[model samples]
Target: MVDAYLSLGSNIGERETQLQLAIEQLNMTPGIRVKRVSLIYETKPVGYVDQPDFLNLCVSIETNLPPFQLLQACLEIETRLHRVRKERWGPRTIDIDILLYGKSIIEDEHLSIPHPRMSERAFVMIPLNDIASDVIEPRSNKLIRTLVQPDDSVVKYK
Candidate 1:
């Protein structure tokens, strides 16, 4: 089994509930095992910022699925949650991203492991530090906590 990290976010329809439901779905996936989860944070939205604030958290899982296969599973979970993506980075009921795949550096049309933008987002960094502060970003070779910058602040949701 490989240790993988996934980032979850939601900005629509009971945001925290959406995140919890996503985690539930992930834990139920055949090849995935939910190992650790960080505290949910209320975060300011990024990219297209006109939407509602999001509830975000990071999850660590043990999975036997390949990177692409795992990516497919995440997408499936989002779809199962009735996610509608009419715009780029638009608000959604659930968004699950493959942040790290057992230190694997993957760059493909369908996915990018270590999530190209994870370091720059407080929503990702704060929770990532909670669970995997020692884990390094594959490309940067630096701890995930070290990459955090204070552009945005995140608050504990519970």
Candidate 2:
């Protein structure tokens, strides 16, 4: 099995419930085992500022599926949860991103493993650090804890 990290967020109706439901669906998928999950966090929206704040967290999983397959699974989960990708960086019922896929580096028209912005997004970094402090950015080869500033405005919800 390969280790992977996923970042999940919701900014629309029943945000926390959407996150929990997504986790439940992930757990139900065959060949995917939900291992560790960071505490949920409340943070302001990143790109599109006019929407509601987001509830975000990261999950660590051991999966037998390959990177693209895992991405497909995540997309399916989002669709099931009522996600509508009408606008770039817009609010949604659920948004899930593959933050890291073991040590793999993949660049294709559809996906980029070790998500391109994992290092720069506090919502991704904070919860990720909670689960895997020593995790490193594949491209930069720097520990995530070292690359992210500590003062980012992410706070645990529970």
- Candidate 1 clashes between residue pairs 3 or more apart in a chain or in different chains: none
Each candidate structure's TM-score, on Cα atoms with residue i matched to residue i, is 0.95, 0.96
Which residue window of length 10 is worst by lDDT in model 1?
144-153
What lDDT does candidate 1 reach at residue 56? 91
Which ranges of candidate 1 are over 4 A from the true structure?
Answer: 150-152
Best model per lDDT: 2
- Please provide, for model 2 over 1-158, each residue's C-alpha lDDT reduced to its tens digit, 9 standing for 90 to 100: 98899999999999999999999999999889999999999999977899999999999999999998999999999999999999999999999999899999999999998888888788888899888889877888888788766745787888
Every model's Cα RMSD, please?
1.2, 1.0
TM-score of 1: 0.95
